[model samples]
Target: MTSVPTVPFHDGQSIPQLGYGVWRVEDDVAADVVAQAIRAGYHHIDTAAIYGNEEGVGRAVAAAGVPREELFITTKVWNSAHGYDEALAALEESLGKLGTDYVDLWLIHWAKPTQGRYVDTWKALIEAQRQGKVRSIGVSNFPAEQLEEIIEATGVVPVIHQVETHPYWQQRELREVEERHGILHESWSPLGQGGELLEDPEITAIAEAHGATPAQVVIAWHLAKGFVVIPKSVTSERIVSNLAAADVELTEDEVARIDALDREDGRIGPDPATIEF
Candidate 1:
């Protein structure tokens, strides 16, 4: 089995630096694909209530033959459940679907600033942690200001902040803010959705030099930058290969070359600041 490094959280817990993300994975096939990922040596599994596959992920966890304590499971509360009571109910529902009494990490899926309820939802996550229903609490797609707002409101900083990040969109400024608060930056679309990013000449050259695939090179870059990354793929071979990225090493220059690929308009996902949902 490959040894994956872990990033420590401010709350004394830790998360695997690399994880399996089941975002677009269908519920029916989630169990099979997640099981394959587990067999490929992935101990971190990222899912969300919006993904609608927590049941399948739970099914795989129950049968993986690996003890539950050894796996890092994460789930998020969706935009619809944005109030304190609603978020609490959402966690209960997710816990039921995941078939676990406590989730390793729970997140508010989006800030939905327009709705003006994320602060209340964040309170719910804080409560969940206090109740021992969640080990760590965090947010996804939350901008730096909102991050500060939540902390000021509750005086509890999120242990992790997940966002769309890749070589094309390095998120340097946001990462700086997170770093100041001791929050880990986790990448969602770490491969830039796997098309243009994997075929970029710079990444391809790095891969060729290392005798690795473009995806591995990119994953290696994420690791080298100390960002927790989750690259999703349903293919069994790709799942295993992605995990092998843990072994791909990159030099400082190569990592800098990839870092220089960041663009002012490289964002491919919804901008959290303006997103309605």
Candidate 2:
């Protein structure tokens, strides 16, 4: 298996450009799937406390005999655990479940702006970093204004901002904001949640040009654009195929063609600043 390149984060550390996302995988199945990914040369695994499968991930990590430092493990604190103390306790719980001493990266799962606790949550995340519970801290689903609030309140810039990004909803404006603050942009739904992106003529054309699949074209676009992408799949064939996407190369014209597929009205997830807890 060929290793993928790593992207440096705001914390002076780096993560694999491609990662495996365990969003909704059941705990019973997560371990084997993770092991499969590891065997396929995936060095990064993205999970969340809410995913309820940290133990499975832990088991796989332990059973694989892979050194902890070689694998980058990331998990997020839930919206309910937003305060300083709650965040600390939640990190401990996550650590316990994952059977690890620390996480490579930790993040606020959502802004939960309506709950009016994200600012405090950001503070808690900073405190967690100071306490050595998490090496790097970031936010998920944060808009520009909310990101500004956290930057102003804590004087710590997020390492990455994970959002529902895909070719359809590119979030160019938000990506600009993230660049201004030196935060890495990560896409949560790079495939548009099984939408028509994989069947688009432009993408298919580019894939055909490179002897790749439409999914590979989309993943290559994300990597080329400097966004960390976590594309999820449980099937072994798809998993292996997705890992192969790193080798796909798209030219400037092909990238521009995929960029043209973005639609102004193609949002798939709720806006963070407006979602209810």
Candidate 3:
């Protein structure tokens, strides 16, 4: 098994820099798919209640034969669960679905700023962490302003901020804010969900220079920049190849070349500030 490298969170716990993400994966197929990821050397798994596959994921974990402590699991509460009480209840349901006593990381799936209850949801995450139901708490799709508001409101900084980021959308400013706050930046759609920029000549050239796949080069770029990256794939080959990216290293110049691919219009996901659900 390939030993993935880990990034240290402020809480002194470490997370595998590379992990598997199950976004649109179906509940029925999630177990087999997740089992494949485990066989591919991936130790971290990212799932969410919105994905509708936690039960399959739970079954896979129960049968994978790896000790629970040897794996890292993460799940998020959906938009409806935006208040403190709802967030806590949502976590319980997720735990029931995931068949795990606790998750390594639990996150507010989205700020859902329009609802104005993320701060309350964050408070629930804090309580869960304090009660040992979650080891760490974080948020997803949260912009810098929302991140700051929650931190200021609760005096608790989320250990991570998972967002839509790839070479084409590096999120430089958001990353800067996270760095200043000592929060880890976790990348979703890390390989460009639609294969955006995966075929760029610059990226291809870098791949050639490093004798690696374009996906590996892209994943390596995230790691070089100190971001936790989870690239989703149900295909067995792609799953293994994604984890193998931990072995690929990019030089400063190569990394810069990829960084230059960032564009103002590169965002592939919804704007966090305006999202209602």
Candidate 4:
């Protein structure tokens, strides 16, 4: 098995460069899926309150036999819970559902700019970190401006920013901002969500040349670009294979070729600027 490397955060902790996400995974089966992922060499698992599967995820973590300190578990606060008091309560509820005293990282699921409470929520996250309830704190689908606002308002910087990123919807501008702030960039829909890019002639050709699947090549591209990639799958073969993709080496030319796939109109997820949810 190939070893997945860890990326350093500005806050003195590191996260696995590759992990498994339980976004659309069913609650009834999330335990088995997460356990299988752990058996396949994944020490990191990403989940959230909105996913409706934290209880199952906690069960898997407890039964996987891996020590609590060895696993990196992350969860998020949903859009509805956006104020300081609500965010604090939200983390407690998530902890109860997850059956854990603390989470490795916690994120505000979305900016919800219309409501304009992300800043207050972020302050709550800072409080969590200070209280030692969360080791790290961040936001998902947040634009650079929002990131800056929270950082300027409070000196704490996010350790990571989770968003929809792929060869098509490459967030070059957002990546730059994260780099400036020393925040790790995390790819949510790293595989393009079954889009045509998965079957594109270029990706297939690259896969054929590398003797790997298009999915593996795409994941390898994400790692080669230094972004944390979480590709989810319930199938046993795919779960194991995705973890082994850490070893699929890509050349400079191949990485650059994939980089060219980014398009201004290629965003498959909602625009962070206007997204109310």
**Model 1 clashing residue pairs (backbone):** none
lDDT of 4 by residue, 1-277 (tens): 7799999888998999999999999887998999999988999999999999999999999999999999999999998999999999999999998999999999999998888999999999999999999999998989888999999999989999999999998899899999898899999989996558889888999999989999999999999999999999999999998998898999999998999999888888898879855
lDDT tens string, model 2, 230-258?
99999998888988999988898888888
lDDT value for model 3: 0.92
In model 4, what are the clashing residue pairs, if there are any? none
**Runs off by more than 4 Å, candidate 2:** none
Candidate with maximal TM-score = 1
**How many residue pairs clash in each candidate at the backbone level?**
0, 0, 0, 0
- Write the residue-wise lDDT of candidate 1 on 142-192 in tens digits: 988898999999999999999999989989999999999999999999999
- In Å, residue 17's CA in model 4 sits off its true spot by 0.4
Which candidate leads the pack in lDDT?
A: 1
TM-score of each: 0.99, 0.98, 0.98, 0.98
When superposed on Cα atoms, how far off is each prediction in RMSD? 0.7, 0.9, 0.9, 0.8
Worst 10 residues of 3 by lDDT: 190-199
Candidate 1 displacement at residue 90 in angstroms: 0.3
| RMSD, candidate 1, Å | 0.7
